[model samples]
Target: MSRSKFFLVVLICSFVWAFVPGYLFQSLTSISWVCWVFSKSVTAQQLGSGMKGLGLGAFTLDWTAVSSFLFSPLISPLFATVNVFVGYVLFIYVVMPTAYWGMNLYNAKTFPIFSSHLFASNGSPYKIADIVNQQFRLDTEAYDKLGRINLSIFFAISYGFNFATIAATITHVGFFYGKEIYHRFRASQQEEPDVHTKLMRKYEDIPAWWFYSVTALSMIVSLILCTVLKDQVQLPWWGFLFACAMAFTFTLPVSIISATTNQTPGLNVITEYVMGLIMPGYPIANVCFKVYGYISMSQAISFLADFKLGHYMKIPPKSMFIVQFVGTVVAGTVNLIVGWWLLGSVENICQDQLLPPNSPWTCPNDRVFFDASVIWGLVGPNRIFGSNGNYIALNWFFLFGAAGPVIVYILHRIFPTHKWILLINIPVLTGATALMPPATTVNFNSWLLYGIIFNFFVFRYRKKWWQRYNYILSAGLDAGAAFMGVLLYFTLTMENRTINWWGTGGEHCPLASCPTAKGVDLGPDSVCPVF
Candidate 1:
């Protein structure tokens, strides 16, 4: 097949896939829910609280599903078939028992609920306390009640839109690359290869199927567990599952890049660009809040895996690993501490008003998949400059931000400059910030700061630093944070008996002076004697 013709077909498919799912499905769902249901004060509160509840309930169940499914599917087809035939059997007999065991283990290792020391626990536990207190507060109880009513409706909207966006991004990228390769071959006067032929010849070395399958299965398990166990569990199971799913999903690119390119800076650049384009409307800080496990560890893993692969191909594993570990630890820790400080302060000070309404930290507002339509609806078509305007601000910023890279590319083309342009990413990012609405200026600035730090320290230091050391450092930091998160989870969620220091004058205690008869012999300590 001729390369040019192939590229043309690929381009066409990319264009269609990108627009169809994102616009038709995600946009539609977001508009309908955000505008009609979520925007209403009563409905919004109900929806918000419900989502929080659902997210918590599903946390554990999803983790079990994700962990088990990944290994199960990777085994033989017989195992996969058994998953279908004995699926219910496994759920009832195997999964349930495991979950029960896990719960018991958790209880034994954790503190009792309602304990004063537990209540006084700060950080994540305090955060959970705040959430619960806020939900049941006299002022917000109405919203809490309403949130329950509209919970399922909003979940469907938000999750559906999220899936739609993922679908669009993947399909668009696939088609775009496919066609680009096809066109290049056609331009060289080669015959157009069939899909199968192209797959075998060009992408056979890419491990594309492995990447796609892992990602798809991870998402499927997450959805199933979230839906089935959302209301059944006391623990925050959904959050756990979400974290695991994100970890695996984020690992896909790292694995691919590791196996293909030996820790190339170009891969990081490509990833950053793709992330910028696809994740624009959402707050970038979410990378820390929701998917920190993936974001921090995956990059380190990519470096390690790539180094290991290179080692197997005759590179020095021990030396490379050390370099990677040190670099990652130094940089990732700084990033985490800095990010926590900045975002935590912002969260405290700004509260709901931070970033525009739909920014990442603002829960109900940041839930873009389900709420986009409503936000856009409120903004309407004409009042694009209004503080609440959605599409206009996003569209303008995206257009300009996207163009910054292109402009850089053009300069490189004309001047044939050296690697100095790499330094321009910082300034270019600053320029992008300038394009955002005044309301979101802080958010953009935060992101710009992160990008600059990431590029300068992490990306650029790869060659100078040892790969293994970096991975170890990143892994250690993540491990520490995860441990703290678990501790906080137990301190906040577990039910415990509370002892009142002051005795009450009742049957359980003793009325007034009657309790003074301590010298009298009681028949049994368990049973108080009648005086």
Candidate 2:
């Protein structure tokens, strides 16, 4: 395929990834009442049933077990917090930055980050090229081995540090240069007024205190009503109302910021912290947390930010949306297939029981266990340092990881004459990649490839591309996925429901359902039994 055509196809798929499954899932599961109420001609009941079934199947295979493992007290608190927080932060700051840095560094050192690779015929395979060309081929045996590698202390420590450092770095950047960055972007933009004018306007624009008081009081009442009538509720009357309120309250500021700023260092850091803290806690609630993490109302807020930025920058919203959508779909599709295949391979290896007892692959749950153990396990004599102190070394490592660019900048200064020296640090491109245990090597590799493609082709080449677009795309996919996830959670737990109204009137509501409601049946019940 031609480059543009290929790009277009990929972009379309990404949009589908952003909109399709997530919207379908949300429409059917959480807010099916919209279709039922507005589009009365359609059979909302049947659609809801079908969606519920699909959600159940997906949840059963993917999220349920992982969620349970996450929340289970059997998993140490420290481990849970570290892994979850790290994963959340990395997805935002580290993954994108590392990918962009690696790709750009590679381009700067060797080629242009934006130029088409199809024109070059080096025949020499780069790390990213090898993975992409191989179609991410790792046999079941290799996958299992990789899974084992993923579970190692090295992988845990490296990834943990990478995430923590990225979080700290982003936070620090916001603290130091946030206002400066905002002003710089604002200065560059042709339409925006100066900082003082903007600040005065913001003060004038904000609603009166009484307005906020009334809104807060209304929200409290709504929360109470939702809590009281949760089980008795039908479709999403309450949910829709709540969502609208949330969108109006939160999405507006995000949108306004996007419309005004070229860069939002302050908001970015705040977002990273919020995402980091909340994302980990999500899985503690249920598997749907993962889905929601990807596609909740936060996603809508992100989308508005992107949309406003695109609008202000004179970029076509349609084009930006399409590009983001295509990238997400491509990445998600590859991730799902590869994830499932590798998971199967790991399962097989575990069944054969070839690895050591605590190996990550053989013990899939070891990620949680190791994280928890490392932190909470350092009790008694280790209490001198405090529970947080055990992670001190790891934290330093993360700080170093976040300072990756600065380190490269220093190298550039030292070797001002020797340009190639900057390339040596390119191996940090594989920082997260190297941290993956053998079992999950395939999955991590796939993710890395996606990151590289995005950074090199999309971010680097499309210099004028609004950064908010990336966040919006991420949020949209996450929101869509999350809505479906919540629906699936209700289906998996809720029982004895009536269908007269949107099939949501049920006796056993998710809020009231016991943690052990689904029989506490982890896996086959006979093997790897849950207590």
Q: Indicate which candidate wins on lDDT.
A: 2
Off by over 4 Å in 1: 1-370, 376-399, 422-468, 493-531
TM-score winner: 2
Point out where model 2 deviates above 4 Å. 1-155, 171-182, 185-301, 308-392, 402-406, 409-439, 446-531
lDDT of 1 by residue, 1-531 (tens): 344444445444434443322222222111222222333332232222211111111111111111121211111122222222232233223432343234422121121111111111110111212223322211234323322111111122222222222332233223323466467657866667555444444322434565477556755764565457544321134444544555546454334322332221112112222322332322221222233344434555756567545544554444455566578679979988966786666544334323532222443223332122221121122222223221123234334434444565566567765655433331112212111111121122222233234334554576334232433333333333344334433553233222222121011111111111224332353122333
Alpha carbon lDDT at 127, candidate 2:
24
- Model 2: per-residue lDDT, tens digit, 1-531? 444454445445544543322222222223233233423222222122111100111111112122222211111222222333344345424542353334422122121111111111121111222212132222334322322111112233434544443343343344334687688778776766755455444332423564467556756765665466543321123443534443444343333332332211112112222333332211111222212222334455565667556655656545666665577679889989966886776544443124532222444434332232222221111221223222233434545545664665666687789865433321123232222332222223223233344545566677455243544443343444455446543664234232333232321112111111123332342221122
Q: How high is the CA lDDT of each candidate model?
A: 0.31, 0.34
